[model samples]
Target: MRYERADLMTGMVQEGLQALVDGRHGDPFSILGRHQYGDLTVVRVLLPGALSVAVIESETGKVMAELEPIHEAGIFAGLVGSPVPYKLRIEWPDAIQETEDPYSYPPLLGELDLHLISQGTHYELGRTLGAIPMEIDGVDGVRFSVWAPNAQRVSVVGDFNAWDGRRNPMRLRAQAGIWELFIPRLTHGERYKFELLDAHGNLLPQRADPVARSSEASPSTASIIASSKPFRWNDADWLASQAKDRTREGAMSVYEVHLGSWVRIAEEGNRSLDWVELSQRLVPYVKKLGFTHIEMLPIMEHPFGGSWGYQPLGLFAPTGRHGTPEDFAYFIDRCHEEGIGVILDWVPAHFPTDVWGLARFDGTALYEHADPREGFHKDWNTLIYNLGRNEVKGFLIASALEWLEHFHVDALRVDAVASMLYRDYSRNEGEWIPNQYGGRENLESVEFFKHLNSIIHDRCPHAFTVAEESTAWPGVTNSVENGGLGFDFKWNMGWMHDTLHYVSDDPVYRKYEHGSMTFGMIYAYSERFMLPISHDEVVHGKGSLLGKMPGDAWQKLANLRAYYGFMWGHPGKKLLFMGCEIGQETEWNHDGSVVWDLLDRPEHAGIQFLIRDLNQIYAKEPALQFSDLHAEGFQWAVADDAENSVYGMLRTSEDRSSHMLVMSNMTPVPRYGYRVGVPDEGRWEVVLNTDASIYGGTNFGQMDAWAHRSPEHGKPFSVALDLPALSTVFLRWRG
Candidate 1:
């Protein structure tokens, strides 16, 4: 009986040692460290570089047993009748060290966390799944968790472990497919990544944490352990005031900026301005511009700068190119204090094919679809997310919430929404797959947007969402319950294209294309539109707004000023790119700063002053912004004046007590007397004239004109005004 027991014990020891050597042990905890065998206590350890191993009682510092080397690969085992708590005294070739066994600790992730993750309902996945600092059993450490179901093994590798995958293999949490490990003595700021082995036991590329709040700069894709220091925000009043819906009724004049190139430090090798510097510089600049909000290009972590942060790898992490996550938070807080809201351009449409990113993570299409037809983005050479998967959808939704909740972002401007809505976007025949309904619409993406918007509205009621959808998808701004995608606003791409086309033409040809300026009003009330002359219009050889004007330098400046007045006066919210305000002559270059020196010239400085005044007038006047989403707020006073290259419109307040008359003349020929109809017979004051001498334009219009009772153009009153050449005029009635 004793020999039979001895053989059984020997077999168990051999199996444990072989499993350790092969790296195939599903539960290293069961075989490693100390265990009791009836009357005897056995201790085993696998120290890859150790020359000898001794089992010592942790409390008394007494050696319990010297382990015998059972394998040449540093597998040691011995009998030790020690107390419950013990440590391993490992002797290397040159040094000695003592530490607790990683495998002996209890599971770091709880069952509830595993269940929530598998169910795709973990809203705070960022806090739970990433490298989170914590205190486990009075030991300071970081609890790392990741979801890599198809991986044979996932190990946390970093400087602490000498970048050795074999040093700390995470324990799998059953069918939840989550691997977790709590490494003692691990602290903040340590960079780490998941070293994965595929199902076939082949080594794959190490992947950064998908939910990392911070990451190393581009070209180095490891995720750094974020500090747990609490952020003290002074924007409590700002947050509370935003509880109401601010998209529709509130004035929204947005200034779109590309952070990296907006302003660079010339002394620092032309490096991009950090978030702290932006807080000091950008906030004051936007405030001076009178813009209600600043819509930034995607600030997520992307490897390539040429992509302009559109091809993002880290959805949850802010780009370390600017600064740490806390610095970004500070910037947002500063913006709020200055009464300027910040909106982030979020890219969930596709991700780049960087090997260290989410591409073929764990040797499988975990975050994206397996089939290239459905997963590939042909235009960008990127991979589309598999939004049909519950976890992927949840991850994206969590990303939106993370920015809004943690960073206090006011809105998410979803990028490339048109591409996300269509499966055949930018694809030829046979290059794309149809949905289950045999339609071009991407059903998964549609449902994902609905879910995402619904959750955001429920949790962050103050925040809003905008879609960069160029297509005329019906009900984009409608609520989800009405079978719509549920965006608060959609970019009026049609308006942008038509207006740019119209303005680019000479006055001789503009009369023939009169519908270009009038076509937007046909459906202006659809989907709560935002008229955006975004970065897309000024980049990629599409010259600057000023360059697009087909005239000499003076006419070009005059045309730009006229267009600005027209856009500000037109129905819907406004979004102008950074350099467009100052009439940047060159196309946007992501590598260079805005033409700040251009402000020294009166022509450029005048445009800047005009934009500031336009914002102030737009915000102060209710007729221009109060009922922008409703058709009742706008009416054409002279829509059929294409023959004279002139257009006039009337914007009325909600109560119908006040109104503003806006008229634009496309030609450079000044009209001495142009009859413009008014809403009431009274003194119509010219509040803003784009041709004012203050704006570097030929001052040729009166400040105030009396409207006689003589009816014209189907109105009760008429005013003979001196319309300036190639300029727009704003007239406020004092009835």
Candidate 2:
């Protein structure tokens, strides 16, 4: 096993409280004490089978052979004292256990506890929180320290001095492997970042404030928060009074919203909605939509106006582009109060070209793996963490936990999960490192993610975590026991790709691939999934859903309605990109505003109504919920006018009394008195119609009394019904 040390501290007396552990390989690591409050030291010996363990003073290093055999499994005691550096070695003989599976090793829990022995009054200052409120007391002359042991030089940059990257350089404290700087008269809103110089005499990029309250757009610096906590959350009461019967998958109907574009501040001229305004207005709007959750695009600090929160600079900080840390926290609190769950679009797979944040952190591959083959992602122009490294793993795990604990987000939609799953992701053969197993599966990354999911579920049982995985990675959302990633839901990319292809084709061409609709059902059964219309489809010339359709205005609406109705009837959960419900005509533009004016037209209103009604009907339908999965819940067949491109199915319940029949005709020519098979003979009420006048659809069918009974077909009876061309109808049997 490899050994490492804890951090350094200063001005302290030394005392050993206990001999923490005795390794089977003759060595002893002890917990040492210091006089100063909250400071500790640890020392490790590398020899086999330590005969004994004892703390020796500098004057008595070779004077005594006092020792005792270590009996405990490992150290569970804390240490305190000035950090001191020392070493020892011993010998023993025993075969160590080696398992083929790397995960068989013992888990590392809590903060790491090991440091070199030292005697001094020189340690770096560190904060113990994710973000600080702008109200620290007597901290103007507080010392600042960073653990950039590899860097030769370090500088401080912040918003206090116009985004300067090197206004104040920190002095290197060599014995402890750190850099220290003190800024007097520092106040809140004084944004800051670090600039480091590597051993090669190269000035590394500026790093973002890991804990900024709010940040400018990406590429800008992070603000130095005053380092205080002031939010008064009744979390215990909140969790107790709350009743969450919502299944991570079943209750998942996400509204993909961009805080900036959802609403704008008219008073600020061109300013978009900040976190505060969005929190207030959006809670009611999202709750009203009947969606179970809201997924915000990347809200982390980033540079560049066009960034959709994808290229993140701040890993632990909420974007200052909106407001302060408190403001962001208030937003989350308000969301919880309104009973609207929020899912952050977390970008752990890659990061932006943030010199002031993560790039070349510590003037070397400190946060990232030193090897470019494993550390770099060329397509995204970002760095991938060395998931195997202890510190790297700790950083990511801590970051994830911070979001859940501090912000109280209900779920995390991990972005670009595919990139994290494979080592050679998006790279040619020569461009990536092969894992120990010599395959695309990055075992270390996979193991780390599994651990992450395990910890999240354990800590916050109600929290939902989803993966935006595009690849056909087996078991993306399966249980960890089944050797899966354990995401609550995985984006059904197959559904999106297949459905888009089928809808974009002409009627004649669609017939050839109409079966694509059922192709994704197989994957849906294996894992809980979300049929998402995420930002991926809208950005970069992919165009809007309307623009992707193959027909004119009427056909376009029909195609969209058909697609949505089919999705609602499908087994998986649903997610709609913003502006899609009202049928935004233009492609999604990150910078330009959404075509909100389009909703004024009746056509758009109709689409919106259909969506709303679908939500209502979906909630009430048992077949839409029961087994929402199993193949037994679904039945498919070609309509009698198969040549006209028609298909129908009945989403049936186990008891069969609560079945719903859905039929659609793609042809523009209406089919009068068409027959569809049903399970029973009863009065069928037209529960929902895609061609209703209310939804800007051509009035093709009567809203009331479109009932029919089934002929004696299979177990007992069957029925025939009238089908409208280019329309979908949901019929519920009223026995």
Candidate 3:
């Protein structure tokens, strides 16, 4: 009986050694670490391609024992006298190295972390799961963790281990399906990836870290270990005053930018400016142009440059194409220093179908859906996230917070929210799924949005959210408590399409489409709106904003200037894409920069000057800035003047302390004496004229007009003035 028991122990030991060598061991810590069987303390280690390994007493600096090559695949084992603090002294073909054994340390995460991770409420998921630099028992190293619940085995493969999976397989913390490993002496800037085997032991492609804070530039997909040092921010005063200044009652003029295409260094290799150069150039340009904020096309890491940051895979990582994470922080700091806000375009809708990314992570539909109809975004050929899973929704929310709180971003303009809200978005009747109650809404995504928005508002009250929702979904900007999506603003897609269509027609036929110009006022106040001329209107076979106008070069400039005057006078916060301000004749190409050369010509320069003046007037005038939302802010003066193609209105301040008269002539023929209604019977001084010679117009408009006490267009006062051909003007009552 004694002989049989000894034989059983030997067999068990050999089986474990073979599994370790094969890289198929499920419990690596159990088999490859110091374990006591009665009296003897056995130590096992894996030093792949090493000639030999010795156990050194850490405290005494003495050689404890030597390990034998139990398996030819570099699995070494021996009795180390007693269980003492020790390090592995490895002699390889290249050199000798000494390091603390990784398996000796305890698990990194505590019970609270496990609970939060399981419930998908971990706001610091980025800090917890990714490669975090830390010290364990006075030994500095990187603690690598990943979520691959379905993976049978996971390993941290990098240069330290000679890129061998068998060198440092991670230990599974089975409770949350998280795998972790502490590689002693690993430091910042080390590149690594997770190698995994599926449940059936089938090898899978290595995955880039989903929570990586920094990554390699495109054409390479490894995650770089970021520095653990805290970045010192110089925007304290800006942050303290931010919440008070950024109210819904204040003006918000966003200048949307695709950083990769904004200003290419043409003299060089046609490369885009880095974060430092962007700060030195873009900030002053926006400040000079009088824009309140700059909204970026998603700066998150993506494999494809052509996606323009819409299909992102690295949610936590800033793209490495520009610079380090610290460089990004510096750019934002510079913006705040200049009193300009930053809004990032965030995409939580879908991700590209890259096999080595989050798609089929762990050899299962882990992050995305399994069914084709439910999971696939056929319109873009992407994969939809499985928000039904708590972890997935939590991951997205965590990513958003990482940007808003950690990166000091002022707001997040969530992209493609309409796609996530509806189950049948861009799908035929049979090619979609329904909710539990047989509705078209994606219920899980709805819940996720409410939760995400509520949490952001609760945690970061200074920051806000915006939605790029094109559908007529009700209460998009309403609070979640009020049965809405809880966004601070919604892009007015309807207004953009209708007005652009109206202006694109020749002045000879603009009267027929005049209704399109006035149609927005009917439903303008349904939600907190932003009149956005975004990147979508300038790409994909669509022409540039300048190209959209139908007329001669001179008339097109006149028409565009007039349109800018009307847009500022309209009742909504504003957002305009980059090249639209300069009147780039060509469509926006992601490969090229905004046509900065156009500013040399008077025609394009005039449009730029018009936009600059419009922004300044919009900021200085309380009537234009403060009254964008309330119903009493705007009143129609001449809504039904389609025959001569003219429109007029009055904008009142929030407290009724100020007022501005805005009038537009859509035709090329000037009206000698166009009578318009006014609220005050006195001298109405012309504040700005889009047709003025400085704006490259026909130089025809009245300098001022006197309002008489006579009812016209239902106003108690009336005024008559010479209106310019294809021009818009702003007037103030000099009472």
| TM-scores vs. true structure, each candidate | 0.96, 0.77, 0.98
- Candidate 1 residue lDDT tens string, 1-735: 233334323336677557656765556666666666666777777677788988888788799888887778767777777546777888988888887666667777778878778777778887888899988666678889888888888888998777777667788887788888888778899999998888888888888999888999987889999977778999988888887655558689999999999998899899999999999999999999999999999999999999999999999989999999999999999999999999999999999999888998889999988999989887799999998887788788889999999889999999999999999899999989999989999988888899889989989877999999999889999999998999999999999999999999998999999989989999998779899998998899998989999889999999999999999989999999999999999999999999999999998999999999999999989899865787998889888888888899899998988899999998998877799788788899889999998899988875688999988888888999888999999999898
Q: Local error of candidate 2 at 373, Å?
A: 2.6
Candidate 2 CA-lDDT value: 0.63
Q: Which residue runs does candidate 1 get wrong by more than 4 Å?
A: 1-19, 22-26, 33-43, 51-69, 76-83, 86-99
TM-score of 2: 0.77
**Which candidate gets the maximum TM-score versus the true structure?**
3
True-vs-predicted CA distance for residue 281, candidate 1, Å: 0.5
Worst 10 residues of 3 by lDDT: 1-10
Model 2 segments beyond 4 Å from truth? 1-145, 153-188, 200-205, 211-219, 234-246, 265-267, 637-642, 653-657, 702-715
Once model 1 is optimally superposed onto the true structure by TM-score, how far is the C-alpha of residue 406 displaced, in angstroms?
A: 1.2
| lDDT top scorer | 3
